[model samples]
Target: MKKIRIFIIDDHKLFVEGISSLLSDDPRFEIVGHALSGNELLSKFTELDLDIFLIDINMPEISGVELTRQIKKLNPKANILALTMYDDYSYVEKMIKSGAAGYVLKSANLSELSKAIEIVASGKKYFGEEIQEMVYNKISGKAAFDDKRPSMNELSLTKREIEILSLIVQEYTTQQIAEKLFISERTVETHRKNIFSKTKVKSAIGLSKFAFQHGIIDFK
Candidate 1:
């Protein structure tokens, strides 16, 4: 049985040490490394063979959104599982847009955390029940937040672009989208940028909103 190799990045030293110790007791997990900040993690990012990254959202210098984006750019195969105290729906949407595979609240028990890790490791997205409810509520427009409306460009989504748009909203990573669509990753990226431009919504969160507004994707 292969152990799930994990790398942790959190600003709190006590949390890092505690989680590392607790994870060490689990025979299925191997905590290969940890860092106290995003910069520190980037410095040693190339040094490890990690399966899942446990990232904290509110770091001092680089926020988890940017960190997760950078990590995905650095290692497209990197599977990020956000481990943060924040339960904000916006944060969850941002992290998913930034290429994180899952989101786990810091409040999660050992069993839930382990389950989240396993789900993400198997190439599926995971979110806590509470977080899921929050996202669903926001998407259904039961909750209020500013939705960045996209400019209705003269150009509209092509059939291919719509397909990609749906997959992107579903939180499929670029690589996975490429595989599923039977296209090159570069092609998938090009289509993604085109969708962004045509919809004039750069953020995936906003793009999903655009999709929902246009009936391209159902909010439900």
Candidate 2:
């Protein structure tokens, strides 16, 4: 079996060592390298081949957000995952925009951490339940419209599009949404493409923000 090569970056040595020890035992993951700072990681960039990078958002210098942007510049295809204690929506948004494939709290269990690595390594996005909830709550509290209220007719979202947006806001994966709506996953993806085009957002996280801002989904 081919093992996924992993690199960890954080300011805390103990956290780095602990994660190294934990993942060293997992057959599916190979710890290729680790760094205590973004500068350290960049210095040895040419020396390591990594499939996934576990990054801490809060660092003394070159914060995870900036590091993620640099890493993407080094290798645009790199799969970056933010593993930190921060649950704030701004942090999550910034990290995602910086090219991170996933975000999970440091307090996450071994299973969730491993799952996040697998998901991101496979080119899929993963946001832990807690992170998702934090985003949902943050979006929910804001009014759907500002002084310039977009008329429903101007928004031009079809009924099916609205349904898919609601499911997306509820944190349903494309496959799950397909199953729930009794449609092919490809069809669901097509709808998502349309939704993004109509909303002018690039990611699911962006979609959630748009959904809340347009009152596409109700808070419960």
Candidate 3:
């Protein structure tokens, strides 16, 4: 079988090692490289011809969202999946915007993780059921499930830009947003500025409120 080359970036060494071991045992996946920070991931990303990257949303230096943006810039086909413990509606919306093909919580079992990878690798979205529910509830407004918000692309934002926009709404510090998105602080700031320019908003709060009001984040 042709194995999928995978890279992982997370701050937790124990969790990284454990996940590496699990994927190593799976014939469908080949663990190529692992890093503990977004900076490390960027520095070493080119060394490994990765087919997919599993990034933790919160990191020390660069954020998963930022990193995914960089990776997408370099290789648009790179499949980035965010593996996080946060299933909050904001996080989910932002991760999708950032260029991640899917979001799977760290609390998920290995089986679910594997399924997420396979599903995303196939060019389809994979959200945990709970996460899906959260998104649906937020978008449908009354949890009626009938009137759903449009797809993330409907905003005309690129994958990475979408991710950054979502993070902006979450009130993440620039440093924290950088680490979670895997970009530098300067880049995050630049993106923030660009978001303001594009959305014609003056402040982060404006963007957040606008996103909520326009059903950009659902809660419709």
Candidate 4:
């Protein structure tokens, strides 16, 4: 099998280093090159032939969205996958509309991220779970909701953790949520702690506020 050639465009040295380290040992992908900004990528774009691009939304001199547009203009068949920390629907929509084949959160596990690259390389769209939920909620406000629980719109939290966070926002006591979900309070407490750790919050109120600010959950 031919390895997918991937070029990364991001200004954060840690992000570039981390991704490179993660993929270097993988057999399915070949890291052809990397650039700290879209401008840098543009300068090196024509010099190397690559199949996929791992792009970040924010950069020093040009954004991944604009870069994706320019890339498509230059090579209409190029596959681009957005990798970022922002799970804001606006960012995802912007990247998608700008020509990214996939929009994945930086929080996604290695397997999920790799699968997105593979799908995009195969000429298919890969919208992360949070992205899909955001689209659904935007198009239909609370239409398919159950019991008025807000939809969790970011993969930064695992599915189970998101469920716990949603319940937390709904003011459900950890015990109540555990009982409702048919799990032990101990399990719920563990998930609650994990949610707090992942979200960097010390309390439920702070978590709710943080989620609201990031568009991870809506109050309506």
Candidate 5:
């Protein structure tokens, strides 16, 4: 199997070194290069052939979102994954919109971080559980949004379905939701299937986008 080549771009040297040391021993990954700023990365861009970019969203020079945009422009097939401390939905949304393949928090365990890298490298999206919860809370009005759009009634979602949807958006596993709601995991799965059908979304992120666009959840 070919090892995944990864580049780290973060202003924090300790963070960069920590990640490099963590992944350096893994036979599946190769740490190609790293940089302290977006401009630094761009300057050395042509020298590295990276399978994934682990980017910090809150950078001093260019934000990760903008760096993602520029990187995508430089190499449209670039697989970018955000590794950041920010849990704000605005940062998450911006990174996604800017063409990030995944978002993982700095607080994530090594296993989760490795899983995110592999998932994104395999052409899939990954959002850390905490990040998903952040998005869910923001969209569900746990964080205030000034938009007064009408409620999501056209879907005719039952109260139970809405409750389940919120939990799903919050990245709660079926087992976790079941345990929390005093229901069976199978029942939670059933609700999830129904929610998918009703919302016409195949993934949690898709459901999130639909929720934001359809006034089921608010952003801003």
Candidate 6:
């Protein structure tokens, strides 16, 4: 069987090395590449035809949530599994909204990470038990996804912003977005910043969650 082609994006060198070592020994996975930030991952997008991406939630420059958005834009079919230490609902909600198939806490055993990778690679959702609890709590209305979710039209975003936000939810990077829309990288960044401000979101995950909760994209 062909090994699953996987890439990773995280800032912690020690963590990346440890995770890489763990994944290297697995016959089912192939480490295609790794990067320390969203910018680096975007720079190497063309070099990797990844079957899945293991993205950290927190990183310098751009967070994993934003990275997921950018990745989805480049390859809508890309399977993203957030690798993070956060088990809070905010993290779970944001990642899911950013088009991640699941969220895996860094504290999880190696077996758990493998399971998460396998599940996401197969196009299924796999939230760690601790994270699942938050998902459940949100669905049960014990906690809210966001305070004020705005509908796409009500958000007052330009048509281009809507188009870009849709792709961001799909994990498209700024470069991919530029190529897709025939715009410059700076233009894409400008639009993204505007989207963030208009949506009152601090990260890609927050905007994605707001978009989903507000029915901005009819994702099938």
Model 6: residue 21 alpha-carbon error in angstroms: 0.3
| RMSD score of candidate 2 (Å) | 16.7
- How many backbone clashes can be found in candidate 6? 12
Local distance difference test, candidate 2: 0.81
Q: For residue 211, what is the lDDT in candidate 1? A: 50
Q: lDDT tens string, model 5, 55-156? A: 988787898999999999999889999987666788889999999999987656677889999999988999987777777778787864333334447667
- Scored by TM-score, the top model is 4
How much is 95 displaced in model 1, in angstroms? 0.5
Shift of residue 157 alpha carbon in model 4, Å: 16
Which wins on TM-score, candidate 1 or candidate 4? 4
Put down candidate 6 lDDT per residue, 19-88, tens digits, no spaces.
6766888999999989988999998798788789999887889999888998889989999999776667
Which scores higher on TM-score, 4 or 6?
4
lDDT (Cα atoms) of all candidates against the true structure: 0.79, 0.81, 0.74, 0.76, 0.79, 0.79
TM-score: model 1 vs. ground truth = 0.64
> Which residues of candidate 6, in runs, are more than 4 Å off?
138-220
For 1-220, candidate 4 gives per-residue lDDT tens digits of 9999989887755456556767766899999999988888888777978888999887767878899999999998999999876767688889888899899776556777888999998999998776677678877874432222234543467878877776777567878998899999999999988888888878655665455334444222
In terms of lDDT, the poorest run of 10 residues in model 2 is 143-152
Question: Which structure is stronger by lDDT: 4 or 6?
Answer: 6
Per residue, candidate 2 scores C-alpha lDDT tens digits across 119-200 of 9998899998777767777789853222232455678888888889878766688999999999999999999999999999
Position 70, candidate 2: lDDT = 98
